[model samples]
Target: MDTDRLPGCYRHPDRDTGITCTRCERPICPECMISASVGFQCPECVRAGSGTGHHPTANAPRTIAGGVVAADPHLVTKILIGINVLMFFVALSDPVLARELALYGLYRDYFGGTLHGVSTGEYYRLLTSAFLHTEWWHIAGNMLALWVIGGPLEAALGRVRYLAVFLLSGLGGSALVYLLTEPNVATLGASGAVFGLLGATVVLAKRLRYEMRPVITMVVLMLVLTFVPLGGSLSVSWQAHVGGLITGALVGLGMLMPAAGRNRALVQWGTCGVAFLLAAMVIALRTAELT
Candidate 1:
């Protein structure tokens, strides 16, 4: 067998390298071989394999139970944004209809009132209200915020944890609104959840010891925008925004808590339990005062 006939490394053409990349099976020279944590791979192979690669193979394709592949391929944030957009269109088509189905129920139908049936309860509103926005602008604003903050946070925290933060924050926001506002007023929007995402970003930045200037600036600007009177139109729910912000900060703190020497699951569960208890208390107190 003529060794000279063997394929040479892509980087070192002079060397007759016989070893092929585990992924692409392309011959590579010692100079071109990059040692990964798992195995030896060529620069081209690694570059085209994963993590800034032209063709990533190391990243697994996400699949649901029963082997059903996801369509969007992102996760909770995209799904949430999609739902909000769809609801926005629905609301735009018929404001009255959208309100009757989702927004109006946030107060009269979900809270304590004549329309509060078995299906319509305060417990459900905590989750449902987050999906129900009043108008196109309402959903668009929230979705824009979600797109800005939700993707990075979700990617950092993972899907399940990200979902927990979003849902809990939304619930916490709604609970606060229900506690503070009059029962006659109908409240609906994803602003609470979006605020929660903002809070999470702040916490994450702090934990990572990254620069906090940008995050602080955004938070301050958001607060100013919410409170400052614009054209004498005070239709925004500052309470919900505040509530979501608080919930997100708390959740982010929970995530940052030291899990090194302690049981991670226990700490997470305990934190979540406390958050839910607090939300429940707020809801209960508000319901009592309203009725």
Candidate 2:
């Protein structure tokens, strides 16, 4: 038998493995392989053969998207909030650093120095901008929204999927802003990521058969407010909010709408990848236009 030609894991088709379940002969990855009396068995075989007689699902802890249940469901959310807060403080202390990290296509600072943007290949700003804020109220509102919306989402999608959705949403927002807004305008904040969690919340609520009116109402209100211009220097990027909201909703559908016993993980991550690819293409097009 050609080891290279061996089939991938039954549970994770992306992972190639030579090992097979001793009883069922099904290929399984390291994570799914359980040691039996004579040889390794897949999770299904072990669950079926368990003397305790509990159901297969009852024996294994899994999240809504089929990830392992973590001891701290909100660990990733806390870390994200902490990073944002820390970056906020750093931006406050060193104003120059904030200018460097903000999302912009291209601009010249007050000092008349030419500051590059995604157009000039300073692409890190696309993600880093999501972690930075200069105004106290800006960070406060975003962090509050994140904690309220992100906690439950992290619990539902698990850390990996939740993180992927978040980052792609942020990138989507930045990409849209670059494509639509003026090159000189600077945008910053985690509003994109927070809006993503909001979108995911709606999807989860619908999937669990929870009432949808309140969620829909909240989404509508926020979206409406995005278009309302604030007088003076204060302004909202409706582009970012819309972009993040749509990206999050699509990702949530991918993660939650799959049937059980299907390749749920693959579908979930593939959706995330598609979201990223769309964002990247937008960025590339905008970069070409700006440069």
Candidate 3:
């Protein structure tokens, strides 16, 4: 037990050692001792000291299954709704702003009138139209949907991802309208982004293992109502709905994929980036077709 004539290593009884484990104070040779912040520790002490049941071999770092979660105040959704409300008031003061922001079916229709203006090739209309609404009821319905869908999505996917899905899905919807419908028609609303949330909700429902038939049923009914030609003059842009739905679902699927990096947060953001890129590719292909 004396330092002058140290005891033999417990692991190798034939070898004499002076070093001892920091935690358990056991006699350990250099080969068996692991370096720690305080002092050297034996393999058993290292394993026992770790509370997470993770085993780290010599020269290897510990592996963790989880990382810190961010606190989301649901700021993105609130900000979006605020911007939409402010734009609505501005449009009320000047009616021409609404016409300027609306997405035209034809690439050529770009003037300051309803759908009859000259085509100005204003490509930004694809995204701008999503923020513009026609009437009080139109905005109210969309804002309600955003509140319901955006909060949970922001919590689950974080603010950046939720925003990406909204914008990309909106773009997807606009691209669809640009491709299918007549150019003379004009469409305005956040229905595309709202429908994107619906599609994402469907995927989240499946992943979260909740019964989604009611949501599905509602979606189907809405699709039917949108496409079915009514005897009246009321019009709905079914193309936006279909486009947003498909894009959101794809992005959700990407989220479900097993993440690939040591940093969980980085991997999540990367997944969202890939999803956005895919959506952009879809829009690019559609644009190529249109050209």
Worst 10 residues of 1 by lDDT: 60-69
Error of 1 at 92 (Å): 3.6
- Which TM-score value belongs to model 3? 0.64
Candidate 1 residue-wise lDDT, 1-291, digit = tens: 874465776766765545566677777543344444343465555545566643443433311100112333247788998898787677668876555644232344344655641124546756776887755566767888998789767654556667777888898888887777755566788888889989988986675444578789999999888886544222678878999999988876775443322365466556767888898888777665655
Q: Global lDDT for candidate 2?
A: 0.81
In candidate 1, stretches whose alpha carbon ends up further than 4 angstroms from where it belongs are 1-73, 93-97, 100-122, 229-234, 260-262
Best-performing candidate as measured by TM-score: 2
TM-score of every model?
Answer: 0.68, 0.78, 0.64
Clashing pairs in 1: none
lDDT of 2 at 266: 80
> Which has the better lDDT: candidate 2, or candidate 3?
2
Candidate order, TM-score descending:
2, 1, 3
Question: The CA-based lDDT of model 3 is what?
Answer: 0.67
Clashes of 1: 0
Q: Which stretches of candidate 3 lie over 4 Å from their true place?
A: 1-72, 105-121, 228-234, 259-291
Candidate 3 collision pairs: 105-183, 106-183, 108-119, 109-119, 110-118, 110-119
* TM-score of candidate 1 against the unseen true structure: 0.68
Write the residue-wise lDDT of candidate 2 on 172-243 in tens digits. 888888899998888998988788778887887787555478799999998997888754444788888988
Better of 2 and 3 by TM-score: 2
TM-score preference between candidates 1 and 3, better one: 1
